[model samples]
Target: MNTVTPPKERAAAPETAPASRRSLLKRPRQLWAVTGPLVIFVVMLAIVAGLTPTFLGSNGLTFIAAAAAPILLLALGQALVLNIGSIDLSNAAIAVLGAILLAFLLAPLAAAAPLLVLLIVTLFGAVNGLLVAYAQVPSFALTLGTLGIFQAAALVLSGSTTVYVSANGEAISALYQSGILGIPMTFWIGVVLAIVLWAGLRFTRLGLAMTAIGNNESGAIFSAVRNRRVKVVVFALSGFTAGLASIAIIAQSGSASATGAGGDLLLPAITAAILGGTSISGGVANPINVIFGALTVALVPIATTAIGVDAQAQNLVYGLVIIVVVALTMARTRGAVVK
Candidate 1:
């Protein structure tokens, strides 16, 4: 046996142990992975609290919530899509079109405008899913192409202007205007949606399937995971969230402007998701954490003001911080697959 042994054969003889929940709980890296983002969130808030002193007061909190709501929803959608190892660049475009189309519908349909708008965006998501999952097109490329088309369509549809809602349009207009216990109604809606998103990703079989597919596509297919169907549904769900976010957007401004209104959110939402501890690679994500991620992102301008940093410097700082955190997290899971 000793005389016949070869180097290549010996190297292949050892099998790696499978990762287990018990081992995960024991690993400090697991602890850091779960706690790091939360720590960042608290630290950011603490800095803000110290700098402004009044920023945590009632009015300040309300202002932050109202501003962060749409971003939170967008981050929610982005997190979901990214969890499945995919990207969606069409969100901002969808939001723009959703708002414009809703405004156009409201003049005639009135109370039915919101429902109709949600349905339209949902269908658009399904189409996106089909193209990405069935056509074998890369999500990044497909979404980018769709992005240009939708943005152009929105502008052309609106004739390059902002859409406005009348005060008389109370039913639809109140979506952004009304509040409960002094909080924006949209904020409550966002909270509910966050819970739903979290539950879907963390508790459902479909969520697990998505995670499996993200973790190992070949293995998932071998294990009978409905990879295509799960991806389609993920895209559809992302679209549904985009629809909700679009409502919030229109509610805030009372119109969907054809001039790149929603487009700006895509990058920030993605940054928030990554910062929230959703892995850049496939296999790990937490939707609930993304809400706090939105909060941390929303705090950027505020943090800049608090620290006397220039607005222009904020993005650079945000990027550096997120990149470092992600790098460290990746290092922690370097040896074995994470899910």
Candidate 2:
């Protein structure tokens, strides 16, 4: 007598079919996932270029690169902290504080800007790490508190006024304004940082472990991951990045003010991280996409001016664009889940 296949085997056969179908669908989804934002960026650029030929000029490009450097640096820091399911609101304040410190204390060591900046940033990072990791406070609360504290410290250091980078203007300028093989220094720095971080996340065990911790801290702990240590390291790295950003700002603007501690930066930095496909809920980060996100954010003002939009209106447009993109991404993500 011929025996039919068991029902369980029949079910397994259909499951395999669905899996193959899902894989086929995944390819297009992945393509759109990256291409959607890219397409928007190109459209925006083309519109701006059509409106104003100067939009593509060398001076305009330099201005965008220079302006984007500090924000890009800060976003990179935020991205790192975010990758591990944590937030760092203290970035702007930390940057201000670092700039003040550099102007007053480290400027004398002109020959050692790189080394001095590294040490100061390391210390700032360690402080953040200790408070967040060992103290067991939520990163949001911890960083928020530190934000105020650091801002106050910056004010005190600057005496509540802008501190000009006149003393070491040449050195600072060289750091931010000079070019390497014709590429702007600031642009090169951002590119290098992005590449290094991308490599780390792709090829390193620590990077995989950080993703695991971010995805599920409790589960990662059960699987023997050092969650606390990893979080601390991530926070420290964030601080370091903030410090680097501060140097860039000081170099480019030649001044630091308390007013600069909170304005036009917080939202965009977070937006860049999210828009780059780094999950707001953490667990995933794409450095390459983040670079594009940075470029997109940086281009907004240029585009607006080229198109003759008022500054206030441009701000509104930026806020609206961020909201729309985020909503779309969320909807697409949900659809994928349902499907």
User: Could you estimate the TM-score for every candidate?
Assistant: 0.86, 0.86
Q: Single out the weakest 10-residue window by summed lDDT for candidate 2.
A: 330-339
Clashes of each: 0, 0
Model 2 CA deviation exceeding 4 Å by range: 1-26, 180-183, 261-264, 329-339
- Alpha carbon lDDT at 15, candidate 2: 69
lDDT of each: 0.77, 0.73
* Tens-place lDDT digits, model 1, residues 1-339: 002336874665564444345545787776766676677778877887888787777466677677777888888888888888899999878887898887778778877888899998988888899999899898999999998998888989989888776533566558667787666877678778878877887788998898887777788899999999988888887787788888888777777786745768888788778777776666778877777778777777666766777878887887776677556433234345454
lDDT of 1 at 309: 77
- The sequence of per-residue lDDT tens digits that candidate 2 reaches over residues 1-339 is 012446975676666567755655676755655565566667777777788877676466676667667777778878888888889888877877887777765457775765586677767776887888788888889888888898788888789888776565677678766886554687678779988988998799888788887777888899998887887778788888787887787777777787774334766778777776677667767766676666677788777777888877987887887777656543134322321
Off by over 4 Å in 1: 1-26, 180-182, 324-332, 335-339
